[model samples]
Target chain A: EPLGLGRPATPEEVAVWDIDIRPDGLGLPEGSGDVATGDGIYTEKCSACHGVFGEGAGRWPVLAGGQGSLTDARPVKTVGSYWPYLSTVFDYVHRAMPFGDAQSLTDDEVYAITAYLLYLNDEVDDDFVLSSENFAEARLPNEDGFKPDDRMEVEFPAFSEEPCMTDCKPEVEITMRAAVLDVTPEETAAKEAAEKAEAETPEPAAEEAASEATTEEAPATEEAPATEEAAAPEEAPAEAPVEVAEAPAADPAMIKAGSKVFRKCKSCHQIGAKAKNRVGPVLNGIVDGPAGAVDGFRYSKAMEAAAEEGLVWSHDELSAFLADPKGYMKGTKMSFRGVRKEEDIEALIAYLRDASE
Target chain B: QDDPAIAIKPWMQELGDGVDVSPYGMPSPYEEDVKRRTVEWLTADPVSSINFTPIHALDGTITPNGICFERHHSGVAKVDPAEHRLMINGLVDRELVFTMEDLMRFPRENHVYFLECAANSGMEWRGSQLNGVQFTHGMIHNVQYTGIPLRLLLEEAGVQAEGKWLLAEGADAAGMSRSIPMEKALDDCLVAFKMNGEALRPEQGYPVRLVVPGWEGNMWVKWLRRLEVGDQPWHHREETSKYTDLLDDGTARRFTWEMDAKSVVTSPSPQAPITHGPGPTVLTGLAWSGRGTIPRVDVTIDGGITWHEARMSGPSTPKALHRFYYDFEWDGSPLLVQSRAHDSTGYVQPTKDQLREMRGLNSIYHNNGIQTWAVDADGKAENVEIS
Candidate 1:
């Protein structure tokens, strides 16, 4: 047996336990109570806290109509739908009800109220008697819902099982495939060979063609699709000169430092290979990138509308957004308070700009 | 410090900077050494597996409000003390209502007792594999409590002749509840309101709790809110499903409440490895019982080959910590050291083999067998079980 003697109880301890209600309902006393009595009692005393019909007022528990809804998204639970035994209704209502003014009800009142609850749950008809004699017969709808787990029977044996010893499964081979890489062994080798061949053959002509196309085109317009005429007259500016060579490749130390700063953004954002959307958008190659670019991920309507407004992610815009996320994009779900440290902000922006390429 | 007039810091400032209300308070910074000694990386889930108090780091008969260890089947309830209420109805002649304040009107008493979890020494049932005294003897705590005797309030409202049990419930969102036999209630049970010399800490049932000293800690509900007197036990989940231990024969030992006689050597054990060489060694720890005061503690060297009575120190109060020390000269030879306690009822702590044979090695909690610390020639100790 678990240890200790049945020690003598003190007056206070005895008093606390003195409140317990019994199975046989022996402590049940004189006075008659019924569903009708409970309905009026509930409306005046309970409906303010518990909703009318016991669906729950707010954070308070719903007391009715949760019958068979335990698995629903918003389970309509109440004393009727969830409680497994009627004894609980008597015990709980008798002990704790009317929120703060507990232990105030007479035995008849508690009995009548319990009958009313049974009526509400559709378990007992209004004509049913909830007295001590018939109370034990009142089983809850969720009675079978709970049972001692059989896990101990199965689990204890496994836990006590002799673990793997010498020469265990020597013939085992790696049969499981990586889910994310999107490659089979043969396909990976073929792709690598093709990439090597393609890399050796420079795509300078294609690169020049694309640059020429860029020079001829204007930036995307406010309209969802830019008109052909919008791209006509910007060719000369694009051809002007490749002056101010791409900002010097960021320092490795600076990138490392910036990565540390990136931790600050991590609670709300994700980056790197295989990054998925968190509270905020993934930042894969986001520098100088098109706005609202990640495919299939939902962006706030504000950001999508920003994209329609021809708002590409320029260096200045990225800096402004980083400085104040909520201010830059109203209605964004990001709850992050803005970064206060300038040095951290600078380092982060530098890291993002370099990593984006 | 003697001037009871110590400057009281604002409640908000007294806590950590940027005062975070942790739903439950934590141990003070001065008690950093006292914490639930946890096994790092032992289990994948922290929400499930947890440890207990560092009994070795604590002093005084009472476990301080914060350092009292906790165990949760689900999780700790984040209850607001102000919003708490306790109701008493059911089998009573008249349903009695009492707020936390209403409970204060009744008489109160101060007691020194130990509240131990049934799973206190559970992990060491198989062998003395843990290397820390904190790990082996850290699950239990002894304390001086102040509360109202339960019998008074029960009598105030008056219990009917048919009332045989009382169902105590908590105001927690979990609505934790338990059933106590009326006999136990009228015995030495207390509705405690204070611990040590101050108001109860929120973690240790701030406003009110049922203090059935020497009983399993779980039954002493925290943030207690309701009490329903009845004719029979409720067979609540805590009583029927979890707290009840199933024996090898499939029958369960139900409603096992009293913590049996147990003892442990806190220092110079594995965690407190021998820093001093071949000189004097002080082996110290705590011993207690739910039945009565611990009267004696015997130390065994060379694997119980011989026994020596250790000197008992501190208050040997009933149901409270009885610190004992065995001091001896070491010759730098490898030694198998162990300690055994004898309670007032003359029940002696049993050996590992005896306990294992009786309870088997299947339980994850409550194996209070004598612990052995193996001292090597180098004067360092490691936890080892003797065959």
Candidate 2:
């Protein structure tokens, strides 16, 4: 079959990707799931992100105990203090897990959630059961704690010699400092809600490419969510756009409230007609269009100097930049914090003109 | 200052936009802060998270396939390379699948390498928390891939001498999988489907992936759907629960897969700080090595007292990414910097107390230490750890 270039793969295409399991039990499938039927199918599909005792629920993945915390100081590593293979806990809960519902379980619900994650890490006994003929009597307490990789016999002979070039260190000291434990990522709450919509009125913010040298200024006692995004619009649906100019851009309840304000602009804009550009642009005809038109969208330099001072988006400049996109774009990298109910910016420009028709 | 190129601005009195204005072109909204960022509380979202790779705003050693670093798990699967396929199957001998025009009829090749991320600089193995070189050594990138040679598709579906592991599997939604062996999938694995020469992006795995050259970017995998083969090694959840390693008397390491000789610096770093001050700077960085090329690096602007040798620049290839530089002249004091690398098998890189006196502070996957920064004489910087 040398260079035969792809063809055979039958047996129902190798039983749909031969699932994968290894560690001495070699793909153990036939069935049998216990530990009280994996605590009732892990409380109906992994207790909303693995918690009802696999005690994890927040940043997911914890699947029980950290037994003798592998040199603790915050070492949790889980799957009963760092898995060495219960066939990678029933092949990662039968391939990929319950997070966004992957491979939907069931090889006896991944052997009853790997026998209830080995009875929540006490290595079994919630009335065991597990099958594939006693999967070689389970095994995992760090199955001889691995070994393999020796970093070329302990770190390539202490970092292979010939290094020192002049005095080679006698005093330098620092110890540590990410801004003295300041933990990087700041973007100052979207630059203090675009500096409170530039003090509420002479607007233009949508993060006008954030920089008044913003090296962190976020704690103005975190002004209660930028004072409710500069006083949350106080009801002025401004005469509901005169009954939305006689409704009918397929007004399915204003395109279902512009498809629920397009889940906050589909996490960085994208519209219909197979909308492309993300992190903003691709409105498919960016409402009342013109300014920095979207062909391969790379706008902002104050939106290409307001599209070279011509601009457009009319309808009252697209309802004053959807009621305050950084007070109306004074340098928009658009971190969105606008459209505060001017009737959901007239139902998101009537769902972006009924999704660009 | 007033001559600014004798002011003929507006891009020489404008008329731009029309080379079919973007049939597919991007970057240059002033390189929008050269993206690929993340650390939104590290991970619990953005679909099995991981982002990093601005590499303090890139330069030289490839990377830019729109700022490299991604590491999905269940996200960017977009697929549809004409409904992708691949397959292969356990202990093969005759079980294939292919498509994507049967792997564009084999015989391709290319190479370049450097995938990294056996947790690249894993949060400085418990010390100097992330401060940029795009979060302490942005996961890692280096590109130029192309494809085929997984020993010409395991010699076109015929392996079996008790296989000896392979696994792979990806088609996303966290179907990640890993295993690998079989003599590193017949040495230098590939299957790629282009990279630095386009085709393959939907978050870097559009039509295919799985490179593994010098191993470990979670064994390359990407949207790569299935491979199988076997006779051991699966222990999946990315190799016995997350790329093993763990050392310091609790034991772990397991298939550690190369990637050692590190380096970093990237412009007075901490988001390229020294915005040109204190005379003739230059500096730069990157170096690499999954066990090859990076012939040498060593910088140090006065932290380890005085070292130098840098200037490596572009293509040194073997398991890719090299770049280097050094220039220097700055006298504005307060420096520190660092670098290190080496590797054309002479290894040398270590430090962070020689990897915490041999793997201890909870071996959060490989680390590659020797980083440092400090800078400050107003040329900013920070992320320290010196010794």
Candidate 3:
């Protein structure tokens, strides 16, 4: 007899959570949707992050294209080119999709999205409908590409040998240097630049003030002003105090609403005292500041040109920019679709003003 | 000036803050920098993102619970242990469910194992891409776990003869799930409830998690809610779309579960570069294997020109991290340092070129290649690749 510890899980309880679809077409819900339906759903639900036509937005996973690119120098391993099974597409979309919102799509929507993704990859026609019955028939182009683990047979034999000792190579030459490549984080670069600047020039008064300002201000604000002047052969310490004093006042409710709206931007931009630069520049004091003025942050050419044109991030300018970042500044590197709601933008501006300061 | 040794220091002269000050103790404020960090650009959102353990800043085998590397498909589930239930059904003679209290009744065992994400060193596949060890090889942690063997629980339910696979699912929003072979489920798999002698941290599945020792971290479903006995593999999104390793020829490799033998020199690496002028230095590292135990580890100083067997110390348990060290007098000359781990299965860690030759550069997971660190004359170490 069993210990009878827990009661039996009800069928309905199991059905709701048993959402996995296997490679052999098991666990798929009964539903049908065509590529046309999927196209609309993908645009409405996915395109904000996963670009139109499955090309991917920013660092989001690409859902289609890149057929036969697995062997390329920079292989784009999208669904059609890399994934081995069609069921995987259905499974992934059903389980985790739309970035933050997961498992929100219906069975028909998942089916349609899967069908549309196939069409985007050129694996199916626009009229092709995908359902539980015909799901396995729509095989991926790389269906036979996958095999079971064979590292023991293929890799272990060679690597298992005792590694060499003494004279493995004749003369080791430094082919590539990390410093020359300069892929290290901005903080390391700034620290090295500051050290070099201190070593070269013994300007105690200015450098002392810069260092003091760094410890006093937000850490993210430390790098740009101190190292920018330090890297260059000039002592421009006057701007540091002014930028530090640029904190803006805001109402609590507006800032609160803006914080909620800022969730959309949180994926790329980080703000606050401990915020470090991520995919986007730290949104510390962008409000009422010069365009593209965040220190050590590489801005798009369009933004640099806008800054050259004497554009400042005034409330109106920020509202315009937040409304349409790319539309306002053509060639802007920001991949986000601007905030559609006016209230959200206003709240975001208030939040950026209050929170960053 | 008077000697500080003779002069009474503030701590010696006065009583310190009482133990009740913290109630629950924390690491000293001075050790604030010892934290898990993430490369922000790696994933779409922080909820589904992974953070790296600060292996460079840590010593010894067990990683502190606070600083353990966290990987969440749907963020950490705040599971109330009292409300949590572990249900065992599907292909079972008698389906059973266990509350947290009921689960505690099962005889538990304590074991130490290293949970490594298959994608731990996946970033460095192209060529010494990430400069820091934290980014390159920090998606792993070793912790002592207290749990009931999954086989014991399965036996309690009495799995039917046809049952060949067990689907482990989480209570997270993503409902992360994976199919474990029946043999593995009955072998060493554990339904762990506690880690490092304390309740499992919320990020590490609070109430319960499946600890599939030596397998990829994803298979260890956190906030584990259910176990379904089945006849076939689920081939779910995680197994089919994500965890599967795509090779150069476009073919992908599935069920690449066992984490191969791998090692990395922790100290004198990018983040923990040598600050003191070269003299007597102890080069230490961590090595582990999913297939079995690590028998030995070798440290190379001159880019394989010389290899010294590192002295294995601390717990050398199977599937657990084995700390290794090589004491050497540093002469301040430029050197290319590397470590090679030899596991119990007579398998040695493969080089990047060898891995590329076999699996190709298209893979985003299961990269157990030997890492190289170029130490310049100034004692700064940089990630580098050698032909």
Candidate 4:
């Protein structure tokens, strides 16, 4: 008040972002959703990645059935097994869910999904309906499994005393060697090339390390940045965080022209750092790439047949396909009528070649 | 006898680049390898993944603005500082929203601190999985930040007596949220905007970020947009299911906010081997403690058998990284080196074996265990766990 800073926020303004939910169920919106309703929504929006049974497809989080497994050597932390509060599921889904598409679900849809998640974990029956009034009745398996941090009381005193500088131990032997495990992959030649090119000039924050950025399957939510996806589900960072430091060198005029040609394909296709398999396979390296090369992406039968026939997407092949999608390959999934202008097709091809790198 | 190489150097015959080139400067072309890199398999997608800092090649306490490791839920939110707003609501006398300009009107202070991801060095828990020190200890960065204390903003909103908890939320699509206790929120926490005397890098929350000094980086929410005061902890997804340390006994520790004392040797590690054939080599590393300042760091060439006190270098700031070095003569033999940090709180860094005995192998977050680098006769180093 003394500084005369910051005006009073309107009630409507506060309501827009105050979406946090607490353990005591203080912020549950007035809505209801049944288990059956949640099942459909989950199948449509989540099962592509989370799996139909919540067993988790690929590296996505398992939403159910990890009870009693916390003490295992490799514990599977799931919504049913590890999460402590039901509010977390509700709040996280409402705020960030369905991966690329977030905050699009309604309150009832989020409730329904929460109910179905409870059912999948066997905490609730198939016919159970979750509502604000009865939300308190539902309890998670790990509700009492949590306690406050006790390191200060327990570990500090033992670690505090002056430690011995000499003769602290009798012997030292190698228990584990990273070379023996050989999990860390060797840096590739392409990366060295990319780095060299990037060093010469700055690209417009267009991330290029797709293989390192997205191709590999990985388990996440280890509690920090690679840290906290958890059972709360999706943490799809806004778009791709600007990997501003690294980018392949290319003509600015060409890249700008290439972006215009890209808008036509942007709806179904994704490129660059944020690219993920959606309606269409990511076309990052599609210009000269092999047909149906993207990992974890399902290709059309025709495309698969073409791939089986050793069809690489050379310049000619792409030009032909772009000119007439239906004529070039019957049963092709791409619905675009095709780029009629020859210059536009060439520019588009040029763009794809550079965009993917 | 003069060296022929120096006389025939290209610099003597050719002119170098002029100042007109590269409007915004970048590291020299020779230093291309000195940049952030990510382990692809660490996360499912780049958008929600994390990259490691090149700590092996870096020196000093301050992490360069460009090379700081990034951890994002929904990638980076490219926010325009002029258009961004910070809202303070819930349990406050009057809900308020402050623009970037309005925040500037208030007084600000500058401080240096380190932000270490709770999952820093997490992969090493199972054993030495990553060969490079960049992979093992790169999930942390220390820098100077300028901003207003969070207490100032809370005071402006007039906090209510019952408001025991504060929920910090990000504007990123994931809408990342974390709950902080009132005691910590009002003490030393800053609503920081500038890092290293410049506006924050886009990936590092450009407009503003909550700086929870001495706390886990996750609680220092980035792209910070809202602060909602409440009566109790929210028990959000990040707090309960993610950041919490899961013990082998099936019980987990929630609100483990502070990063325990941790230290790691940077040079003569896997990435930065003893290229000079092991003579007159200097072993250097970084140490820090969330409880307070790291006053001492001990280095051991023969693993834990014997440790000599390392000379602490750089400005020793509380809750910030302290650089330490040990100069010694190497006889070109196999060596196992490790560093132990002693914080102002008198807490000595624990060994991997010691930590495993207390917390078990499953606690991925807050390993803080001593790391060992085994250098062979060839002066090539490898990441290895010593027993």
Per-model i-RMS: 19.5, 17.3, 7.1, 2.6
Select the stronger candidate by lDDT from 2 and 3.
3
Highest TM-score model number: 4
**True lDDT of residue B271, candidate 4:** 87
Tens digits of per-residue lDDT, candidate 3, B1-387, equal 877688768878798897799998999999887888876546657877788899999888999999899999778889998888888878887777789898888889999999999888776666666678887899999999999999989988889999999999998887888999999999999999999999999999998999999999999999999898989988777776678877777677889999999999998898888888789998989999998888899898888777889999887899999999999999999888899999999999988888889888767688888888899888899988876
User: Model 1, residue A344: displacement in angstroms?
Assistant: 48
Candidate 2 on B224-327: residue-level lDDT in tens?
Answer: 88888888777778777777777778888888887777888889887888876799889888888887888889888888888888889778978788898989
lDDT of each: 0.63, 0.75, 0.80, 0.84
Residue lDDT tens for model 2, A239-271: 122233344445668766866776676645666
lDDT of 1 by residue, B1-387 (tens): 387556565863565456556645676678565566564322223333445677666554557666677654334556665666666676665465566666666768888888887766654554443556665566677778888888877776678899988888876533557888899899988988888877776666768888887777878888887777877778654554345543343333556676767787777665566777888887777888877898888776676666778899888877777888888888888887777877776566766676555545443445667787777787676666665
Report the CA-based lDDT of candidate 3 relative to the real structure.
0.80
Which tens-of-lDDT digit does each residue in B1-387 have in candidate 4? 987776667887799999969988998899998999888756667898889899999999999999999999878998988889899999999899999999888899999999999999888776777889899999999999999999999998889999999999999998999999999999999999999999989999888999998899999899999999999999998898888898879899999999999999999898898988867989999999998998899999998789899999999989999999999999999999999999998899988878888888778889899999999998888999887
Q: Give the per-residue Cα lDDT of candidate 3 at B21.
A: 96
In candidate 3, clashing pairs total 3
TM-score of 2: 0.31
For residue A326, model 2's alpha carbon misses the true position, in angstroms, by 42
Q: Which 10 residues in a row give candidate 3 chain A its minimum summed lDDT? A: A218-227
Native-referenced Cα lDDT, model 1? 0.63
Model 2 Cα shift for residue B217 (angstroms): 2.9
DockQ of each candidate, alpha-carbon based: 0.02, 0.25, 0.21, 0.36
